[model samples]
Target: MIERWLPAAASAHACALDAVLFGIHWHMLLIFTAWLALLVVILIKFRQGANPEPRPTEARRLWPAIAIGCVVIGDAVILTTLALPAWSARIAPPPANVTPIEVRVTGEQFAWNIHYPGPDRVFGRIDNSLISASNPVGIDRDDAAARDDIGLLNILTLPVGRTIVIQLASRDVVHSFTLHEMRVKQDAMPGMTTRTWFTPTRTGDWEIACSQLCGLGHYRMRGELHVVTAAGWDQWMKDEQVRLTR
Candidate 1:
């Protein structure tokens, strides 16, 4: 029943995230129900009709302590068993044999700048002074490695079944890169670089939203994520290369 409230999980990490969310929701529901029931009982017991005269009541010291202790234990159990392990696994390094498709993402005022290291798979150097209207990421055109570098505006493409490693940064203010389907959210901070990785298990198109309020145009700061099959990704890369060379 609760699954209907969430977006479809499209990445490998989505399952763990969904499980954590469900667990929290269920715990909250249990707590709410217990509190509601206690409130109803207290209201009935202390109603005007039930007790005409006001009397000094003795506090249930042991029960209050027990309730607090139970809450603390519940929180500790959830943190130790669910939250911490999931976070550790998420930040852990990938396996040696797994080759991830690396991409650089730079967030500006109202756009997402995606950089793909062309066929060589090596990111070119960037100069902040060289940033221009046309060159959003300030790619150094004179560098040999930058000859085939591809920069895109508000578009990111990934191949299914392969891990995607994104180096996230911001050019001006802070922005949050959020992908609902993939259950990935990270902050893109200026003067600081953050790394995030996800493996797309399904092929589909989704929106990358900026969760942070950076500027006036923050509402429109969105991008497209195209997850495709391996062959389709290769074809698209070739097509992009042709477009750039021409």
Candidate 2:
């Protein structure tokens, strides 16, 4: 219910993440109401016409202090029950029984470089010197492994129902790779690779944005995320193969 106004939850783990969001909002609402009620009671009991003098310290009620303690405990409970477990699962490896599709995503100043391993499932060598306006991912075409690798700028396509593992890095400064529909966000730092994985449960198109302010053009740093059905994925693979053979 908390996510109805937000983007479509297109990933398998999206619902779980939404549950955490719901819990937090409801918790805050209860907190606000409790504090407001307490304030009203204090105002009525200590009104100017009734008694202008302040109450003695020993006569003070413990209920107010107890209420504050309860709020703190509730927050800790929420962290243990919802946030921490979801985070642990997010960092967990893909199922060992199934082979996950792997992609290397490099974040530049104003764009995302998507590199796919193609049929071989092995990423090719990348050279920083080869990076340019045309070759954002810096794929070494001379390398046999790189010959079949498919690279694109600001476009990510994945087959629905498959687990995807993405290794992320930055070409320059720090950038955040964010997919709102998938409820996935991770920072890409230069010289160090970060990893994240997700399973697409629905077929649709979504926008990928850089959640961090990296530079002057940060507002325009965006990408396209596409999830396709099985037949559509087959057709895409065939088209890519035909284009690669040429």
Candidate 3:
């Protein structure tokens, strides 16, 4: 039943995340069932007709303490056994031998700004003072590093089976960068840069949603993420480089 509600896992790390979520939901279900059963028992046993006169409660404080203790233990076990380990693995640095595809995502009022460091693999300088409607990210064209930079609006393309690191920021307010298929979500905050990484295990298109409410147009802030083959990625990069130069 839990699996039915979950989005399809498209990233290497998504299965682990889904497992954690499944465990949490199952735990919550069990707790809810136990509470509901107890409520029914208490209501039936303590009905007005069952006890003609008010009596001192026989319920001991020990039971409540034990229940609270059980809940605490359950939470501790889930955190230490499932959540902590998964989080540790997620935040661990990528292997030195693997070169991840890096992209910069900047959130605005109603759009996502996707920036790729062209063939050089070096991000160019961005000047806020030079920001304009046309130059949203303020890439200084005079800088050599900026010459081949590719700036895109609302489209993120990456290669399957390769790790992708996205440096996230916001131009206006806080926005959460969410890719449901990838099981990745991070807050893009103004004046601060955050990062999240994932390895695409499938080749397809997915929605990139702003999970946080930032402004009046927050509901419309959306983008697309396309995962393609390595060969396709190479061809796309070449085409983008050519387009940038032109």
Best-performing candidate as measured by TM-score: 2
Quantify how close model 3 is to the true structure by its C-alpha RMSD in Å: 2.3
Query: After best superposition, candidate 2 residue 186: deviation in angstroms?
Result: 0.2
Candidate 2 residue pairs in clash (backbone atoms < 3 Å): none
Question: Candidate 2, overall lDDT?
Answer: 0.89
State the lDDT of candidate 2 residue by residue for 1-246, as single tens digits: 666787898898998888788889989999999989878987887788887676678358698789989999989988999988888888889889988999999998899999998777878888889987666788898998987787889999899999999999998999999999988999999999999999999999999899999999999999999999978877886787678678
lDDT of 1 by residue, 151-174 (tens): 888999999999999999998999
lDDT of 3 at 130: 75
lDDT for 71 (candidate 3) = 78
- Model 3, position 161, has a per-residue lDDT of 99
Better of 1 and 2 by TM-score: 2
Query: Model 2 — which ten-residue stretch has the worst lDDT?
Result: 52-61
Candidate 3, TM-score vs. the true structure?
A: 0.89
Pick the winner on lDDT between candidates 1 and 3: 1
Badly placed stretches (over 4 Å) of model 1 are: 52-58, 128-134
Badly placed stretches (over 4 Å) of model 3 are 54-57, 61-65, 128-136
The superposed Cα distance between candidate 3 and the true structure at residue 31, in angstroms, equals 1.0
